[model samples]
Target: MDPRVREHAEIIVDHSVDVGPDDEVLLRGHPVAEDLMIAIAELCGERGANLSVRSSSSRVDRAYRKAIDAEDISQSAVSLAGAEATDVAIAVRADANTFETSDIDPEKTSAMARVNKEIQEEIMGKRWVGTQYPAPANAQDAEMSTDAYESFVWGAINKNWAAVREHQAQMVEILDPAEEVRIRSGEETDITMSVAGNPTQNDFAERNLPGGEVFTAPVPDSVEGEVHFDKPLMAQGREVQGVRLRFENGEVVDHSAEKNETVLTAVLNTDPGASRLGELGIGMNRDIDQFTYNMLFDEKMGDTVHMALGRAYEDTVGEANERNDSSMHMDMIVDMSEDSTIEVDGEVVQRDGAFVFEDHFE
Candidate 1:
């Protein structure tokens, strides 16, 4: 096994989820990541943690979804039981075929998401982390060779998270007490939302392996204006590009996509909260300098900002703030490398992707 694979597993077990003595750990991944899983399991054993491994196959999932009627889709009892019993849950993504589920009906996908929302929330309530394995399919999706993709993944994952926390703390301080934020990019994107009493979270590879973002929930009815996500994202096995949304009173009043508009429509129509802004996040990890078709990596790249359209994490919401609830939380990114400014309460903090505190700010 490559030393980097062990290092990746160490970060997941020791740093991300912090598996400890007697902890009940639920590990889920595809067989393609067996090496990484073995390393993690070994580490868990050394730590005296009990491990339960679940293997997933995208092809099998596609088959099941294709065969099942939309109305018959329901939450899996075994999944719910595992989620409820686990003390720590670690999910790894290693796709053999990224497009295996592409033909599944969007409505069926949405229905499944709706039914599994409870299990998702349950898992979210535990110590959990999600990371990606550099499978060939994912490498191809990112338009990089497998070896290059492995280097990229480990470079982003095996790092000093303490320094990252300190660096992102600056943004957390800026957003935590601010009442409102305005984001603008080129002539196509301009948006505003209230953070108000919401708490800002400084992520440093704990909840998300390779995490390097500062995020917070927007007040349920406080978002207004329009945003054009120039970056393309893979959603429901399809590439969605040029997503433009207009928000009125925190709900998406208008939406469109240059590609896969139907997927976007299905997502927005998933639930009542699906059309509202849930999270506002800023990417701070300069290490992830390139775009990957994966949200796990792309949303953490520097010179970008992301927003999720549903289901705010409870931790990011203040006791007094209303949390946005939905079955889905889809993140879309905007390029802020040029002609962009992030204003906090009317004062510009970032201009053209450089924060005011950085040495290069002009």
Candidate 2:
């Protein structure tokens, strides 16, 4: 076993979920993450914590999606029961084949997603963290050598996460009190929305490891104008790039993508809430400088911001903020490294990939 696998497991157990004595820890991951899961189990044993693990495979997922009818695909009672009974839930995403389900019909896959949304939300309510374990397929998808990709994953994970959180909180401080936010990047991207009354979350490895983003829910029905997302977006096990969206009254009235336009169309048609904005997040993790085409890392890259379409997280939008609800929470990334400025009620907060008040980050 690679030493980093043990180190990664230790971080997840000690810091991320903080598994302690007599705790019921539910560890879920793909087969590629078995080593890390074993490491976590060993650590849990040492701490006198009980650990339950579920190892999955892409082949199994592919077979199940193909075998089951869309309507028949429903949430697992056993999974929900496990979530309810567990004190800590750590999910490892180790994709043996990143695009394994790219060929499946979007509607079929979306149906499964919808069915599992509530169970997922229940798991999210627990002390949980989602991290990735590097696999050969992920390296190939990222177009890097396995060793290089492993280095990248570890580098992003083994950071001073606490320091990153402290730095991100400063940006949250600025955003929490703001009434409105305007994002502009030349003529290609220009969008405005209200953040008033929504709580801001400073993410630093709480929900996601390698995390460094400050986010909040946009006021439902408050978005206006057009925006273009240049970064490649991963959703429904496929990649969509060069997205341009025009919003009116918070609804995605018109949208286009240079690649996978049909998939994009199907994504919007997933449900009513799929057409509205759910989250607005600013990436602040300077260490994650490159895009791996993985959302967990890409959305936290410096000089970038992402907007998600679908259900709002209760940490930002309260449970009562139920107007926006859907199985889809697709995040589309927008680069802010050049000719872009984020204004909070007419005052500049970030300009050209850097925060306006630079000292706060330093």
Candidate 3:
């Protein structure tokens, strides 16, 4: 076993969730993450914490996807009760099959997400953290060798998290009071939204191991103009490419996708709030520079920007601040490494993927 795996577990249990004696924790993840789970369990046990582990297999998910219909896809009442009873929740992702559900029905997939809305709400309301392991399937998706991927993953995970947190504080300071934010990338991406009274949340590898982004929910009815997403995003068993959304009065009035247009359309039609912007995120994690086709890391990649459609975080300036609400939260990335600028309150904060004021981040 790699010593770093244990170290990673210790960091999560001790720092991420802050599991203490007599604390009740719900742990769930792929069976492939057993080693990391063991280390985490041992740490929790030594701290006298009670943990319930749900070791799941990717094949099980595949079976569920194939066997279930939209109406059949509801949250387990038992699981909901369990989550509500737990003090902390830690989930690990180490999938053996990244595209295990590629053949599943898109509507059914959306239904599954809709059904689990309450469960996600309860979990996110708790002290929770979700991280991923370096699985072979993940490496293949990132188009890198397993060894290279492992190095990339671990290097991003283990960092000067304190520095990262401090670095992100500057962004929060600027965004916390800003009313309007504008993003421009070349001529294809130019969108404006009002943050107003929303609270800005700065993450530094806490809930996510490779986390380094400052995000906030935008006022649902204040969006204007259009934007294009250039990154490859996988959604509901389908891959979407070249997504473009045009907004008016804060609702998506027009949208297109070069690939998987049907899936994207179905998602936008999921509910009333699905066509609105929920969260506006600015990526600042310089350590993670590669596209892994995984939103967990890609959404935090430096020199990139991501926005989520559907539900906004209830605690952080989303529904908490009267932002958009829905059962879904789909994040899509857009490149901002060059020919782009993010202006907060008409002040240029970042230009061409580099912060105009980089001192605070360093």
TM-score of each: 0.90, 0.90, 0.90
Tens digits of per-residue lDDT, candidate 3, 8-75, equal 88878887888999799999989878889999999999999999998888788779789876676777
lDDT of 1 by residue, 91-128 (tens): 99998987888888878987998899999999999999
Indicate the worst ten consecutive residues by lDDT in candidate 2: 318-327
Model 3 C-alpha lDDT versus the unseen true structure:
0.87
- The order of the candidates by lDDT, greatest first, is 1, 3, 2
Give the candidate number with the greatest lDDT.
Answer: 1
lDDT of 2 by residue, 73-137 (tens): 87888877887898889989888787787777878877877777777878877899999888899
lDDT by candidate, in order shown: 0.92, 0.87, 0.87
Steric collisions counted per model:
0, 0, 0
Q: Can you give the lDDT of residue 233 in candidate 3?
A: 94
